[model samples]
Target: MENIAGTKSSLSWAVHISVAALVLIWLFPTVGLFVSSFRTADQIATSGWWKAAFPSEQNLTLRTDPPSTQVQKGGQWVIEGNLFGDKRGATISVYGTSSREISTYKAGETGKFRNGATITVQPNGDYVASSDTKWKGGRGPRVFVTAVTPPEFTLRNYQMVLFDPANREGMARAFFNTLTVTIPATVIPILVAAFAAYALAWMDFPGRALLVAAVVGLLVVPLQLALIPLLSLHNDIGIGKGYLGVWLAHTGFGLPLAIYLLRNYMVGLPRDIIENARVDGATEFQIFTKIILPLSFPALASFAIFQFLWTWNDLLVALVFLIDSTGETTVMTKQIVELLGTRGGNWEILATSAFVSIAVPLMVFFAMQKYLVRGLLAGSVK
Candidate 1:
């Protein structure tokens, strides 16, 4: 008994450790991207997002105000300004007159120039340069600074991604375009598939088994097989390539699985409730709309999520059926690929774009995860 209890405790600990490890593995990249999205391009390039929460020590080359900006202050010529320009939180640990001696003077200490001038820089980046004689340089003198910059984050990446008109890779239009594609594609299939599934499952019909079997077979058919044929058909029918073509194509491809899942779920509903509804003079359509539809919420939500994510992230379908040379209707997935080609080295932009693209799907999944889980489990049992 004692040995068995010890073994059980060991297994329980092992399971917990394994689960914890899996959670960390899944969250690591997600957390990294979320953090990177808030950072500026320079900061993202200089350091990892994991290190974003702490101050960073950096060597910076900067300059003071030029001779043209020098002013007469108490009979001395002086150039005074803030080096960091509204970025007031940085602390200059040390600085120097030359690059070779970057950390020669501590923050706030004045360093004498070769021309009998002295410059003092505070921790907050405020600087004052004064000379007993008139200043002579055409440009400002170079100042090398070693500063402890506070952790920085910005919404500029998001702004550029979402709102900047000059940004060709902006997700604003693509996000809406994706929504335009997804909403109809997701909804139309549910309504059509639910009616068909109800007919195949509950309502008696000739060749019902054969039709269900056909839908099941379609589940195994590769979408690639239908792409060329479907596109040709769409073109021939004058629909061409646009939101309508894409929506119809998504609905067609998604219906088989939707029908299969819903048929199985609907068939498993208690026959007594459906029979009694019919006995109370409920028509087939009425029974479906008023009774089966309400009880089949889990299945509907599950397939809605599946189709929404599928159509939202579909690059091939969008490329083949929807997008054209006009480029007005590019979706998020296509926009991300465009970013890969145009801003490949720009990790901040890429990270933020990628994060924005996925954020909606993640929210949808989390919101409907309970229904999705129940639908899967219930569908499998029946």
Candidate 2:
């Protein structure tokens, strides 16, 4: 009775909970990356992305107006300015004149300098410094302040990561390079595998079973085992290490799964349709182009998503086959690795670059995801 058709299962609630938990587990870091990408370094350092919408306390080292801006006021030289400059709305809680005493004076109190100069800071970040003797030096003294700042977000991270002309490690070039590698790597295998899958699924040929077994066996072959030998072969053939080599490598590695997935899917398509098309004077080429390709879109799209993501995020293959001393052919994965080495402490930049790296794949996945489950499940039922 509990398993009656059209009745809900007793564990449906558990399934729902499990799925929701999985979604949240995957979603949390992605959402964190999206939020952190728009934040400043100081903000990122002080708090997590979950706290981004709330005011945060931060100890900041700032400089007053240069000594050149000092003026003779009454009998003393004076420098007056807002510590935040054009920025506003931060409330200083405590201030200090040196790094060792970062919270020595509460806001709105006057603290005396070594030379009898007095400086006063207000909670609103306004400050006035005065000294009896004329202030010497081209730069003003440093002021460290502990302030509660309102939530702040900026597009400067994205600008620096994607568009800054002077940024040598920017992701723009790597992004386009990844697209260059990914698109061709995805499309070429799909085109080749679609024909092979159609032939395997429908057209009778000698040694077909052995070829299918070989493809199945190839699926279990470790990609790393063949890299050096395949690379040597590429060099021997004059293809060398470049886009062509990497594209072929990705296509070769991707073809087995593509053929397996598409063959299973094409085999499940109505056989009567193909037989009728042949009986109605359609050639095998015509039957395939007109009948098989259109019906196999879901499987094609499913494999596209897989291959695109694999090729896009692939660092080892690109490192072995594509990257050179010029660095012009570098992809996002390699560029991100370089960033980890060079800018490990710059969390905002890392977050922005990581989010940018996943942006295209996310778009592609969401666009074609409906077909993914359908394609995977095509021959499983019948």
- Per-residue lDDT for 208-255 in model 2, tens only? 999988988897789999789998999999998899999999999999
Q: Looking at candidate 1, what is the lDDT of residue 137?
A: 60
* Highest TM-score against the true fold, candidate: 2
lDDT of each: 0.89, 0.91
Tens digit per residue, CA lDDT, model 1, 117-164 = 899999888899998988876988888888878899899999999999
Model 1 misplaced regions, further than 4 Å: 1-8, 66-68, 72-77, 94-124, 130-144, 279-281, 378-382
On a 0 to 1 TM-score scale, where does candidate 2 land against the true structure?
A: 0.93
Candidate 2 clash total? Answer: 0
TM-score of each: 0.86, 0.93
Candidate 2 regions exceeding 4 Å error are 1-22, 378-382
